[model samples]
Target: MNHFFRKPILLITATLFSGSIINAQNVGIGTATPQLGKLEVKGSTGAVSAIFYDQSTGVAIENNHPGIGFNSYYNGGRKAIAPGFGGLLGMDPASGKLHIYTAPASIATAGAPMLLTERMSILANGNVGIGIAAPTAKLDVAGNLKIADGTQGEGKILTSDELGNASWQSGASLVPGASIGYGTWGDCATNGNIGAYQPLTGAAGVNNFGKSVSLSGNYAIVGAPFETVGSNYSQGTASIYRLDGNGWVLMQKLTDATGAAYEHFGSSVAISGQYAHCSYCRRPRRKWRAWFCNHLSIQWQHLAAAKNYANQPCKPGFLWQ
Candidate 1:
């Protein structure tokens, strides 16, 4: 049974029993006037404001789903929180789905109501949704996602490691240079084949590139016998490449400086280790000239030294017909 005591000006009512006070429909502790809601407790300096204790041993909400609800009469609405042994649990009562919401501001005054935005949701079937209410997949997100692991780039793709960890990686750039064919002369002339190596600078032209090619380990040398240098037609050149993470990259372009037009400097090429040799028919000397380039240094000044092997006997592997 509760009794009411009416003050002259305040009109206060209360029923006190064993230090507990109940006034009409409102309950107040350490305060006579509870202005905010039905139940209010005003705590002093050295004490805790409020505490919710659960007696359950396991990590689950066993009994009734008890929660505190907040509502406003203005434009905004209600936000409920259910505190339990499994941390803070927020759920939609009608759908029984776990929903997480965030408010833009901390406080909401009289006229201006608080707006709550739902950020994440976990369905009853264990499907998680981000930026969306209903999820069709196991983990569904409506917005764009970025995985920054230092290997991500614009033109890269995701690749998995040995342990199934994924990271962004670059693929080889297949810039078409020329076509190579195999078989008899009639078959090579009629059927067009596919495959080529990248040029030193830009795209390769109608020059007879890949007419002669030599490979030594991860290094390769290709001959462009009909390549024109400056005003000299068919002066010819050879390109050397080294294989790396980004496929074969052009290292240097080899050419005979003292050779004249129609000499075809890179007619035939051979590469053994770091040494590269290129031979061509010298029409002026009526004999073949070869440039034995020693890639022993990074400067690549060895290609400038041309050697005339006119009188010397032709070595078996070095000189290819």
Candidate 2:
């Protein structure tokens, strides 16, 4: 005699859990029809549908394939899963590298391998890379970067402040037919010659105090190529002046470190901003040396120097042009 036993099933329907239904075959919470999978949950509009929590290792979602997939729907219609159709965020366990990928939106095969193009990454050591796999600096980018902080626009360049913060600033503007012209010399009686400036200590004799002069903004630099220094004849000096309420005041005097006779330390001078360049020519040797000075304070600070003879190559410190 053949005998068969039937398994008993228990079905529970609760009204408190938003019409939760439980049966021997499947479980459905917040839904009545759980036909999609063994367990299905449906949430109300604009509310969370599901949540996974773990304190130790965090929540994990897995698929039978390589990378985890995320599905999105619009009006109950599934979007095409393609290479460029979606974005991917992944971490390489072997190399400890994190990568973020992007692609164009196009139709592709679902569950098939995608040609993921890495657009950004973060190394295990905390270096962030953009459009690059490896980053040597804290923030490294392999492509052109645009900073639109409201100050960026056409004809603007990136500039940095004293603290290294960057911002966009307007470039130098040139006016049409703009040129600087000098006035008549030795005419202090008129505006032609603003005022006569001379070194109080070196006014004893002829010092060639005005041999060379350069003006930038409100500052002026005068070169005295024949000024004597303690017994060093014609050692040369450069005097810087600032235009203040009391007229032009002598700010600082610059001279070469080496007080050798006939060095002509300030035969040529050029001033720009808070810096000045003093150059001297050795006509006999057909050579020249130039020194840069920072006059941010009342004192002059030597910044850089370059020396070259007619037969030798110039050093890197100073540029003639």
Candidate 3:
């Protein structure tokens, strides 16, 4: 995060044989005198440097770097041109990572993937990692999956700053300009333009096709509606897909995990680890949106409701073990 602080004034006396008056902006030590705009500082061979500013805008122009300049994307505002950091050139205070999001939004921007968010790609040796990085830190956040630009036009890509000697994996999607989602082992990119999430070909389809998806560890569960999953509501059919490799593998097509699936039942779902809690709300004269937990089993655990659950009357909130 950007920070600005001012230290309180402290006074000290000089016991020098030769002395001169020291101004608030000037200092005199021994036989040396220094000033902000005049006196120079030489660190090494190229240490002594001067910083010039724009007469009109007062922007920094030392060497070839710009710091804290004016911006006009939204309202022609002002932002900082960050120096190199976090393996690249910027750090996102929100996530404490050195990546592109660290760039001020006035420039093109996108949401970075959180830890445990997986991204795949085709590496240089035709393996996986392409012209990017894989999430290798805690939760493994690789800069391979692209951060999507949600605008009608293309969005800016957050490049993979990992300089390594690893081969590429097949279909590694951690490119800089993809949608963002929370599914590792598969594909999930940040839809940069709109900040929306786009999951790759895996367990996400089951969750995204109808209701929202819940993730636990490496597993994600989605409630497949009869309309989306093309299941027979009359026969009470619900499906759950497991994440395998870089794609989704259908685990099973459930029937009556909640004893009997209601017309529009199975709306909201929450997944954790291997547990998936879902709410089933019948349609038309829907009475209640009862919840059930498909604990990776054929049976379902009915959750308590506030009586007469409507269309997703309440979500299934969970606590970690």
Candidate 4:
């Protein structure tokens, strides 16, 4: 029974085995068999580079409280995941928190995750909003964004998506002579609401503009520089349509407010609000563009076309480029 030192070797083996069990307990994990006490681990050194605790091969230390049984150490720390492609599964965006995903099938509100998202950006209230993105999209919430529903646009909503061209929506009140659609906001009251898409050369010629495509209010006053110097802006006619009980109904076709013709589009009516304002380029390029003032006589003698004017403040009758 007492050969040499058999008991000492047995004691050494027992001590090592006991140490493994104690380590597992500290990490709150179960042993090889289920229902054992939790196993835990502490960092020997203060700093650890790796984030998540790897337990793929580690033992499942047992837990005896409520709910699910086994527990294992997962190194979900402050940052959650690498900055590269972290999702809701990432560590907390805030400090001292861990991100957790709720069970898909189970009704655990523990960590409710939003569906249909590759990555989630936190809102001001810490709630998540859904956003589909393209490759060229940037990831940031630069400023305040508003969301509204059920509120219709203030005026006439002219959509051109059906026409396969530039779509536009103008207010109910339009003005006369204002050549809308890149040309000019054919005359209207208040400020000319630019149509969605306008002609680059709508003011003087046709299809003769290389300006970058853009959108403006009222009449879609597009590419032309500010000062178009011409006497006759009568060629540009403004038509008004109302959305009736059935469909869009043409209300009126105002050929001329002064009953005279200027340049085919001369310095005619500029559309704004629900009216038009037109004047001689020589008068005041800004005033004549979108002003809707009551006047019987549009003196052709005073009117002139826009020649060289670009980017100016829009008045009641005009819009700044």
Best model number under TM-score: 2
Q: Local error of candidate 1 at 245, Å?
A: 0.6
Which is superior by lDDT, 2 or 3?
2
Which predicted model would earn the best lDDT? 2
Global lDDT of each candidate: 0.61, 0.62, 0.37, 0.31
For model 1, how does the per-residue alpha-carbon lDDT over 162-217 read when each residue is reduced to its tens digit? 23466555543444775544445324334445222233442266678777899886
Stretches off by above 4 angstroms in model 1 are 1-204, 303-320
- Summed over model 3, clashes come to 56
lDDT of 2: 0.62
Query: Between 1 and 2, whose TM-score is larger?
Result: 2
Worst 10 residues of 1 by lDDT: 56-65
> In candidate 3, which residue ranges exceed 4 Å CA deviation?
1-208, 227-237, 257-262, 283-285, 294-321
Candidates, ranked, lDDT: 2, 1, 3, 4
Off by over 4 Å in 4: 1-117, 125-267, 272-276, 280-321
**RMSD list, candidates in order:** 17.5, 14.5, 22.2, 19.0
Error of 1 at 17 (Å): 81
lDDT of 4 by residue, 1-321 (tens): 667755544434333242344433432222343234354333321122112324221112211111111112223221221111122333333442222232223222311322223333433344442242112233343345443344345664544322233333443456698554334343332243553331122333532222212221322222222222334433343333333223444444333334323322223344343334443222333323332332123211222233325545334333222
